[model samples]
Target: MSTDFHGFSSGPDSAGGAPRTVVDWITVAGDQLIATIKQLVADGNVRRVILRDSSGREFLSVPLTASAVVGGITVLAAPVLAAIGVIAAMVAEVTLEVERTDVDGVNESEDGTPPPSSPDPEV
Candidate 1:
């Protein structure tokens, strides 16, 4: 079985001078996890996929690029499935961190201004 999850966070990297957002979703089923990762790669906007255990500790990080997909999506699946299998044996929830391309902060706001910034104490 599979469950739905949505997590929002940002990274320090700039995309074309704009900031990029790392969107995360957590799931338990290894197969479903693989499928989700595959789709993310197919979409092309994904920068990378971070695999994490239930404790939120990342174990595997897959960097996706246009060249990597040149062979076909199947090539990417092998490593992700193997990693997921290893992680599933040890943890229940696995987190998939999908890094999206930089978005215009002003576009996210109703007004033509950047969003207010708050210090993330945890960072």
Candidate 2:
């Protein structure tokens, strides 16, 4: 029998920009992989399944028996966990609020009069 696996990694760079995060990597992987496994089963060439991460760590393994493969709970759970993680992450974080002021808005003149609305017509 033939088996297929895929791995992925997510992280941020050192720059001050936004950080790289895997919001739904696991869920996407699980959904796609399970679909592939189902297709393989239909093709009659797959007998076992194994999923791994970028660190070469095996996250799940299962024999491709008719009943077990059809009723694989791990396959279903992976996406759920990933969804929860992503949702939690998306909801838990708050954005930084910065107040901006226009330099011209400050009344620098002694009289405190706003600058002329328009250039002097004579000038």
Question: What TM-score does each of the candidates earn?
Answer: 0.59, 0.30
Lowest-sum lDDT 10-residue window in model 1: 114-123
Worst 10 residues of 2 by lDDT: 93-102
> What does candidate 2's lDDT look like per residue over 1-123, in tens digits?
222212221344324343332111121232244344344334322245444444545454444445544655444357644643453344322111111112232212345332232112122
lDDT of 1: 0.58
lDDT of model 2 at residue 59?
Answer: 50
Q: Top lDDT: which candidate number? A: 1
lDDT (10s digit) by residue, model 1, range 7-111: 554655344666667464545455456556666666555677788766678888888776766644666766667876676666656767666555543313434
